[model samples]
Target: MNTKKQILALVAFSSLFISCTKNDIDIVPQNYTIPDTYTFDRNSTTSVDYSGQSSRISMLQEMGDYYKTQATAGNEVNETVLNNMYSNSGNPFSSTDLNTSGKQLKDKTAASTDYFTLLYGGGSTVEQASVRTFFQTQFTQGNNASLGNNAAVGVAGKYLDGTSTRLFAANGLEPQQVVLKGMMGASFMDQIANNYLSVNKLDAGTNVIDNTNKVVEAGKNYTTMEHNWDEAYGYIYGGDIASTNSFKFWSSYINQVNNDTDFNTLKAAIDLAFRKGRAAIVANDYTTRDAQIAIIKEKLALVPAVRAVFYLQEGKAKLITDNGAKAFHALSEGYGFIMSLRYTNKPGTNNPYFTKTEVDTMLNSLISGPNGLWDIDNISPKLDAISAQIATKFGFTVAQAATVN
Candidate 1:
């Protein structure tokens, strides 16, 4: 056995000598204490570093804001510019740090080992190209606004909303919502639940040895393992230790879900798991570290699942009232959230709650008709079935997730 396996075996053997409670079953080794917060240091210098993740988050913020600008009158989304931003090439971002950060969203979407590797097996290379298809469709459909056709079955243009307008494609789907919320799953959530948090990245090669020895990389403050863990946390919290403001993408939806009284405890629970897991890594308590990983996976998975149902409920109610603009907007968001479901971690398993095929099927069911949302006069039955499926997998009732603004 290797050093990590041997040490874990010894720890397991030693556990028989101590009586432990359920809460403390994975006892910390003696002489090392876990910090109350996510602070870790050696020689009095802090070792936390997730600057790479911070850069990507900021990149998405700039990119999403730029996409939203295309919705305005007489503005068009330049496909090449958006593509450049997605790849972070040709200095697409206005921020100097982001331009030089060398991080790009195009490479990260649906790129996690647990999601992409399992879903695509060895076919991950082609999957990257396939994922960028969303960008092409977003710009293609969004640019349709300049055509001045009122959005309908095969027409793409403005959807009027109480004197204002939101751009919609021929199928009543907002182009930006599809790409933005799709990235919430394909990039942010996938990286956290599947890529950085997975053992493939966390304990790969000498990561455990390096982290356990406090052997910081040359010219860097943190060990490889420490950096990997923080990267996962950064995706959700955006490197903001307080996690209170400036929320974007997945963090924005997480905050949205947390605001609902039915699911108010989610943010705190997820934040605590991240903090405790980082502390456990510092203490060399791999058992506790792994346990916290499970908690993070399971909790993070629910954010997408609950939000998918919530948006669907919102769309169904608005559609019932014959509000086309509001209904399409809600349903478009629901569509993106459902697309996100394939990226969720199912706890103790590398698989997501739903497969890519399953998510695609659900998405197709939503907009299967020629008219899409425009044709669906009564969408409650379809919405309820999709919501119930999502809620059932997460062990919550659709009614529970649907009871909010």
Candidate 2:
């Protein structure tokens, strides 16, 4: 019995030693040579087409412009045009019949096609009803001429008193316009910068591995890495990929910046990064893929940051010149851009470049003063502070961003 016990103990020790040795010796060698190019099947059924979203934005813009023009002319608000903009039934924007047929149809009883209403409620039935009620109130208020000159205009950014009211200020620009534009940067641009293209999602375990091996998952048409890259591309390109002009969505803003010599280099780099990232995905070169994604995030983030600072400075300068309307316009845009900073991607960290609290603090500073932008006191200090916060978060000096024409 003692000899048997001794034999068991010896076997246990031998097993432990073998396990340790195996663990110590096990090493999966990594392939250092990443191919510069690879042929890949680019066609994939897993991609989401954002053409609907793009079309919706364009329709909203057209509707907003029409309302603006009507209000500016002080003409009797046209109910037909208003109804066609967004309605409980037969909304022209999302109607496939109207879009495909190219036929002008009015009040076709097609069901409510309100995009904002749908988005605001997250497509909830209860929330949609509430949104419809809110729209009704706004529409009713718009039709009332006694309320104010701008009351009939449901468009955002139009000021009734030309400067004091929230709904429509004296600038003839609806606050809604500012809200929508800010949403474009915050939601759409940020989705691409911080969400879809983010390393966390793109480089998740087995994703890079699957991508490298061109392993298409069951029921998926594309490899994991290929699908991820395409998803990021969808946010910006939507169905616009076929077009040679890749600068359609957020790239449009970058195009404006490109006009300025200081930002032209970045504008070029932005397009190049996206192209290289897509190519790297095809090549299964993760190092190049990651580098390009970083470039895209940093450069795209700079657009809002640079614009926020630029508009803040412009607002201050306009205030100095006593151009209150123009000052407010610029400040409003700056405020929107500031809010977008919370969506900037910070690689290796779950947090964005700025937090929501930080964004609110900066926004509050701009609108909290006794006279706000109209206080007549130099706002350079306040603008400088905001600029510094952005600069610090993004690893740039305020001076560099401010001086970037």
Candidate 3:
């Protein structure tokens, strides 16, 4: 985990992210130590105060609760949208589709023209407009503008806000839905990065879908999964990025920017995004692209591969086998998603990991197995502290990260 993210994660899982309401007593803020009932800063998100108990157990419990509640909700929505997207993708043969149709009647058209709201669900139009406006304001004014790279930060802001409703739902504020917002945001950016590096990202985003398919073999539900091109080519032309990796995100940014426009701020945003792209590539200020990529790679190498077991009552079960590459791809894509573009660092321009049918098979196998169900309880808020840990590990948005646990 990066230092900043680590601090946030510690704060989130420490006595700060979760508080005890089962037995409410007079509470006090950590700093004041007074007998106040509400022990938190109003401005601070993920406020936690359970008296003097920095108890790890309590922390885990609280983290679990927060994650499960929000994650389940988000997953329900995510699965629905993904299912709708590939309802007919019994087998997504890119060659066949590209050959048959001039353009696969997909969401690209929608994303390009109506970035305010893709064909997906969960977010309202009013909310999208607000989120778009927020990014616009920030691009021209916020920390990015002050640094002369407001346009660059602008891209991050737009991408962040559009991914999840939870971000803006935070008191109807701009991108305040901290938990799911972060998770979904992480997912989107990760997808972009994976695609940029030519790593797979699709099949992996469906971790919850596997578990939801199990029938308790009783109670259950289900869930796959970018944008940009032209502007991206421009970047490659300008040498901010190679022609290859630059296209996907650059086009996406351009299409997205045009789709979600407030003309007054567009020019500035464009300039800033160009600057941000350069900065990311290792401009004079901040870490260069190479350094950032190295940092991301180091962090990923240290991350533990996901090891899970879904113990179930002995019963009828189905097993399908293939190379574990698919599972690894899914898991790795998720890792990159949560951590940002770091894991995408690859030899040449190719992303080393990504979603594929092989991965889908493994992931489905895991979730469909007995151990899969058990892990639900394991990853449940009552047990594991997945949310905060994921957030800290990946610098994900607080919104979605809070739900992963």
Candidate 4:
């Protein structure tokens, strides 16, 4: 029983005592999990079952509606950078078509420079990180996982082998994939929506169809579908075989609805087929830039998070006149749904991250970094080329391409 022996004994006793005390049960009740005050009807918008109607088209349409609502809200957002995002003062369209008494009509902060005001004429301040955080959360947070899953966003995020022409040998994807990603995919969304919409109203015998994928009729004799219809023959209209996978041209499919025996059945069938079909295609093709963006109609539909923060950034720009507000707003979700609605990535880099170039140019074709496209000069100019790459890759206009730098 020397000092060392006594210390060891004391240590053993302490360990035993703590172990015994650790087992004491404290049964605290579990905390409550409350639902969000605002949430997109996931049940209504997303597919729980990949069964019949549970498809990508339905998902996109639902998400599209969500974006449309957000766009409406975003249009109303009037911060410094986007001070005029929702001005009713001069634009007759805003006065008559786009506004409601109490509701906010979200519009993209499209202008190079403009602004939106706070409620009751309150002014806006410019903060970059703050806006980016708010906007990113709006898209990535509790809204809908479908809207922000790693599945599509990260499907094929890797450096592309630097080439002169982003050619079409990805195999059967050859030339088509490029078109889908750059040309068709960019315009495909609205094009497909309108195509389906055209066929959506056709009657079979004694049935009527509505926007929702619902029907109220029966069938008779339907006609064969024709994808070569005048409406289905262009960049946005043309439904290129997105991948080696099964591709359905909803434009043609919807047009064939009249050929179906039951108008209601075809109506339901076509509506579900096209809207959900496109969505499904987009969902499946997320690995490719074109298809991924095609399904990502968030920008066109107008996400409020994107718009709000975008305007806030615009406000900063107005106050500072340095584009700091614009750049800062680019990062926020609630401030500007840029994260949710748009892809910011560009081409020619060793990274898969988005660039402001992509966000700036959606459909206008200006500078195509055609694989071995734009030649990079000095390091700074090469970085500027990333913006050009994005604009060209996504089919943006020359003007937009100029703006990206």
TM-score (C-alpha, index-matched) for candidate 1? 0.87
Model 4 per-residue lDDT tens digits across residues 4-82: 9999999998888566411132222243222231111222542212111112222223222342333333231112212
Over 4 Å off in model 2, which ranges?
A: 1-53, 56-67, 73-174, 203-224, 237-249, 376-380, 395-405
Per-residue lDDT for 1-405 in model 3, tens only? Answer: 899999988888766425622112212223322212212222343122211111211222222233233332443222222222222133222234323333221221112111223312122355434433432332122222122111121121111213321211101112112221222222232322322212122113322132123111112111111112112212212212334554222223333223322222432343443333223221112122223333332333222111111101000111112111122222223322332222222333333232223323433443343433223322223112333343344343334322222
Best by TM-score: 1
Better-scoring candidate (TM-score), 2 or 4: 2
Those runs of model 3 whose alpha carbons end farther than 4 Å from true positions after fitting are 1-186, 189-192, 195-291, 294-349, 370-405
lDDT of each structure? 0.78, 0.55, 0.26, 0.25
Residues 322-347 of candidate 2: C-alpha lDDT, one tens digit per residue:
55555666777777688667656655
What order do candidates take by lDDT, descending? 1, 2, 3, 4
* TM-score of each prediction: 0.87, 0.63, 0.22, 0.20
Report how far off residue 269 is in candidate 3 (Å).
28
Model 1, range 39-79, lDDT digits (tens) per residue?
77768988887788888888877766776655554467676
Window of ten residues with lowest summed lDDT in model 4: 107-116
Off by over 4 Å in 4: 1-177, 183-187, 197-374, 378-405
Error of 1 at 23 (Å): 19
